[model samples]
Target: MSVNLNNKKESWYMFKIGLVIAFSAVLAACSGGNGTKNGEALLTYGNEAPTLTQNPKQLDLLIFGGTAGVGLETVKLALARGHKVTSVSRRPERMTLEHDNLNNVKGDFVKSESYASFIEDKDAIISAIGVDASSEKITIYSEGMKNVLKAIGSNSSTQVVTITGIGAGDSKGHGGFFYDRIVNPFLLKEDYADKTRQEAILRSSQSRWTIVRPGFLTDEISETRYRVLLDMDGVQSGDISRADVSHFLLAVVEQGAYINETVFLSN
Candidate 1:
């Protein structure tokens, strides 16, 4: 009876030690990576990764092209987060967002003086300005960006985020063959050319800026779990919703990551 009791005590002790070791291993796996588990790289598509931190404070945001697409979504999201948003667009009445802190200003991208008053004392500026695919003369992208740069001259403290397509910058080949070879050259040739010029203007500007290149925007609901690739290499072409893009932009503003960096977004 004494020997059996001693054996049982030893077995219980070994089981407890094994359980502690297993729990410690799990903890180490979860805690060591950069917002990732089990040595996985964060921001890789299809990988379970931690999300970017959310910002809770109210901020003053000035957004251009706020009537449509990503711009409209950004305005809605910003207002929902209790931030003061000034939307600059050619048609102010088109912006249907009704909020106490939302202000819609009628302005043209080509003429910065028209909305220069709205840019003052803004915490951040988001430029979602772009020309349509049917546009033949694509000078609006660069010219509008130039106007924005001039409007915010020497204001390096204010964060600036610009939305451009995937083929805008050095991400020419990452959009797959249909986009890289045919669509980019034939369908969006003029538009992409001006977008490249737009990127150049932002790069040379002194303001702290982040250039977001989204792949094939769609109107689907936001998953809120998207990938941000800093470079074009190994990036797969996929469609991401405008809502997701807006979420990422707000995250960038709140988290202050990727400042002075160009990143590509995809689902």
Candidate 2:
């Protein structure tokens, strides 16, 4: 019988990788998971991970693009938590979620003043905007962020938390192996360029801020068990549900945590 040594070695290596991934998942579950790469929590500011304040404040949240996606999830979550929620949408009539605490404002995201003037009174302003561009360069994120920064100015006490995605800033190459090698370079370069510009606008601004970078978004239910990574080292892009993304967005403001930092959320 003829044995192929290279094939045997390749098979063993592949199997080892599979076992390591499985073991990591089991270990993470058994350990209740650490928020960081080496078993330390990320998003620390006088505490481990972002936590609810000992006495949580009923937040006044103004959300841009709140009619859809993560923005909609955030709006729904905020209302459920008894917070005063203002949803800025291009078409307010399209917003189906309603509560006594919910206010629907009609306006384009690129024109912040037209809708978010109530920003001055809010505890936090959450910008959850994105674009789908194939031909024209996308500017909705940067442009909207510019208008938001202008409206926010230098005096408003509103803490800002903006959600960008996996391919922005220092997070440019950390969306696991396949995404970094294929999806990002081939598909999302233009979108991510604008997202990078959006990040720049927030970093250069004077407002209190936290930028969340969630991995490939799914429609799955929120487990609230995702990993929060502040460092790209040893971090792999994983699936995180949009519901979980909203949860982190709310936590950042309600708990008054993850300020001035960029975090990557994955499961």
Residue lDDT tens for model 2, 1-267: 999987887676556556545754664465422233433444341222344345466888899889888999999888878899988877788787869999898878787668756777789989886665332378888998888878877877789889998789988876655557655655567789889999998999888989999877879888777767777775556677889899888888987787899888876
User: Measured by TM-score, how close is model 1 to the native structure?
Assistant: 0.79
Which segments of model 2 are wrong by more than 4 Å?
1-55
- Clash pairs, candidate 1, are none
Expressed as tens digits, the lDDT of each residue in 1-267 for candidate 1 is 247876676576556545545754664455421222123433554422125455578889999889999999999988888889999988888887788999898999889889888887777899897665532568887898888778777854788898988778787766655457655665567788888898898899898899998877879888876677775665646667899889888888876768998887776
Question: Model 2: how far is 39 from its true place, Å?
Answer: 14
lDDT (C-alpha) at residue 113 in model 1: 88
Error of 2 at 34 (Å): 14
Stretches > 4 Å off in candidate 1: 1-55
